[model samples]
Target: MEAEDGKLKCNCPSGTFGEDCSLGVCEIENPCLNGGTCVPASNIADTPSCICPPGTFQPVCEQCYYNFTRDAYIQLDSQVMLAINSLNQTQCDEECDKDERCTFNFIGLDGCYIFEKPVIFASGNGDLNKYKERCMQMEECLLLTHILEDNKCFLFNVTLNNALSILRLIEGQHGNNIAEKICC
Candidate 1:
């Protein structure tokens, strides 16, 4: 907190500034929630406001997001993923191990949600939860399924640019190799 011109000011997050910080950064023409920072973008392809802080997940950051497992690996925030946050990190880990469908685990918030398979769009709210869990047996780029999905969930060393091109080739285009190619 800080004071300016004899007025009290709270240390607000990105995209917000005011007395108590109660007012939404984009409350007027735009809006952001769950502590998701708002960034004004001139590009039409981008959104007016959407950051979805660690605890919160969603383009709008309205849901609590957490996920904790093991082996802590690198993950890109921009990629579409299913994430959730929970106050109980242990619960997150337990869920990951107990679920037989789990294909991969991600660490975030306090609890992590495991996927039966490498996954897609999933988010939770940070505003309502706190992260407190950890991962125990996470594998780094252990599975090649991420590459097949083209879901933008691969490690830096696992660039599949050429692989995609090869697999995407139409039948009879790449000859023998094309016939054996697999895609998901």
Candidate 2:
């Protein structure tokens, strides 16, 4: 039959045939190699062509070139961030290993950043209970000051003794001064 362009149509003699004889029927052995995708040609023939994705390049899409490694991570600021512009996992690992300060690597959308050091806290000395108690007491005292001064407590970093002295001074000024200020 005559095709839309008035060309004579026939089953592809090349062992590939489809609408208007325009389909690529690669051999069962897969003529397109190296991860190449075979697509039917637009022409009135059963021939197919290969289209390769990134990190791969070949006429038959059978081979991957160097420098196309996957994603990887690096350490940064006591955190494991991902490396930038890493193509494959192998490349990413290699890059991270090259840095002495790097402790760990992580892969993410934004690539990697190297952590120079890990975070540390004094609580490692098994004094966590004491530290927690001190912090809680400090917070409670701060809250008490806020309550006694109404919601407008002036910020200060007074020592515990100094804070008590201030409280005494306020108490001496007037019996109900603290309560009046707080309620108002």
Candidate 3:
């Protein structure tokens, strides 16, 4: 724009607003979604960003990392279970490598339990409700798989590499059921 004094005037840039363009741009063209909060950029040269709500992520908060149901049992593939004793960590790892179905293992004080579950093991115990309660108290616990016959509960922390596996576990079918944590 041309000012009355013949000087050039211009509008605020992409991520700036207000009279002097000092305010960060957010409300004008908010990029956030799924209830995410828009955080304007510090400088006019930079673009605004979004702060995703719980259970959601990505630049626009369009993706979700948590399941919608809490403590809900999910069916998984027919997994082969093995119970062994006195196996060290290296031996347990070797055992898991031997079988394509063996995805993870739980090493207890007394023995090791191997299964084809997808999520990584954080901790496990014979008491189902006890570990389930402990998983609730933990901030990183995203999924829990329980073996009904053995009365074992295993806690898992979800990550990008394992999120798809966890989702597949939800869609699988078998006798055993896994519990997924719901963030939203």
The top-ranked prediction according to TM-score is 3
Q: Provide TM-scores for the models.
A: 0.22, 0.22, 0.38
Q: Across residues 1-184, which tens digit of lDDT does each residue of candidate 1 receive?
A: 8778987769876544456665443664455675677766555334475776665544555543123222222233323233567635576667667766544565655456555433221234221111111110121221222211122232211223433432232232211111111111
For all candidates in order, the CA lDDT equals 0.38, 0.37, 0.60
Model 2 C-alpha lDDT per residue in residues 1-184, reported as the tens digit of each score: 5565777677455655566554446544355765677776665254567786654434555332112111211111223233466446566567768977555444444454333233111111223234323323232211112111222112123333443443332322211111111100
Candidate order by lDDT, decreasing, is 3, 1, 2
Better structure of 1 and 3 per lDDT: 3
Cα RMSD of predicted structure 1: 17.4
When sorted by TM-score, best at the front, the candidate numbers are 3, 1, 2
TM-score, candidate 2, is: 0.22
